[model samples]
Target: MNSSFGIKHIAQFILFVALQILLVDNLVLFGTGFCFIYVAFLLFLPIGISRMWLLILGFITGFTVDVFYDTIGIHAAASVLLAFLRPLVLNLLTPRDGYDTNDSVNIHVMGWRWFLAYALMLILLHHTAVFFLEKISLQDAWYTLAKILLSTLFTTTVMVILQLLFFSPKRERVDYR
Candidate 1:
């Protein structure tokens, strides 16, 4: 990657991780679904990025968050899993026309339906893995499952709202000669 692209991602990494640690982590929804908005950084990565890089980015992001959360490697594990599964999820949801190099995995570009499906699936997977790993017991299976579902729904909502507010679709200009 070029210097600028690298720099942009670095900035995003810092911005997301800080927000997760300092802000969203404390914004627990009814003392359950902690906002993991940091995952959006991985979700919003460029479509053309290599799988290896995806894994690396995911690990680094999760590891950074884990450092703050002091929860061993739960975040890292979930993030890596999400990164590994990302391509499979994209392949499963590939459009009939396929993807454009310039196409991003944002709501505007992928449409609300595709974006929701994609985000919800990943968010649920990540939350399930994280909560299960954190609890590490079936003693309260029902409660754990409820936490996973609630966290997934809350995190997914936050991701969608952030996309709607901050990120916009690129528009190509039309020229007539």
Candidate 2:
């Protein structure tokens, strides 16, 4: 919203879009359709960001992907849901002290295992929701579930890889005051 944050937001969003469109989008592993790293953008936002900002960021990120992939509103819907769920999930996962205003949702802070759990949870939720909704027009339950599960799994793997590859965000250790 402010000038400084505006720059960071644009940079981050562009990086997410680029990584997703240029890097992750091309990757397919063993014919499994493995990767959708763009989902990470929704999950990695700072904690305590306002609801309106979250939605706006979600819409921007999702719409960018939609523009590139021509997937209608599927990415937009899934990204928004993930963004909405992120704060709640982070709150539950964080300790009593809580994260800082500009803290990151990353393995360095959350621990690799917990980060993986968080990433997997968001990715699965987004992919499953989007995939299922998209498939609803033509596919039955089992078929939809299959598509969702496989796509979710593949996308999640790619998202995790990209998260680790780029962000390893530094965590600050604080001595209790």
Candidate 3:
């Protein structure tokens, strides 16, 4: 990647992580839903990013949150799982025309419907891992399931809003041939 691209991602990493720690962490709805907005950073990465780098970034992002939230390795594990599954998910959602290397997974680039599906799948998996790992008891299966579903909805909604508010729409590239 170019230096500017690397710099941009670094800035994004800091911004997302900081926002998660400072603002989104406390956003719990009805005591069952928790918004983990940091996952948006990993989800919105360039489409053609290497799997190794994606996994590494995911781990770092989640581990940083784990360090702050004192949740041990729950976040790290969930993030890694999300990263590992990301490419597969992209393939599953790939249009017949396929994706541009520079494209990002956002509402503007992929449309709201596609972005919603992508976010919902990844966030659900991430939340499942997180809640299951945090509370490994089948005794409260219903409660845990509710938490996962609610958290996924909350996180996905916040991600969509953030994309609309902060991220610019995809610019059409013109060829002057």
Give all candidates' CA lDDT scores.
Answer: 0.86, 0.73, 0.90
Question: TM-score per candidate, in order?
Answer: 0.93, 0.80, 0.95
Please write out the lDDT profile of model 2 over residues 1-177, one tens digit for every residue. 355655665788788789889977877655544467777666776665788888888888888899998989878888888888877777767767767766667667667777877877778788777766677665487766665677777876766666678776686332222
Per-residue lDDT of candidate 3, residues 5-80 (tens digit): 7778899999999999999888899999999999989998888888999999999999999999999999999999
Per-residue lDDT tens digits for candidate 1, residues 1-177, read 666667767898898899999888788878776779899999988777789999999999999999988999999999999999998999899999997754567798789999999999998999889999999999999989889999999988988888888887763222211
- Pairs with backbone N, CA or C atoms under 3 Å apart (clashes), candidate 2: none
Best by lDDT: 3
The prediction achieving the highest TM-score against the true structure is 3
Which candidate, 1 or 2, would have the higher lDDT against the true structure? 1
Worst 10 residues of 1 by lDDT: 168-177
| Clash pairs, model 3 backbone | none
What is candidate 3's CA lDDT for residue 170?
68
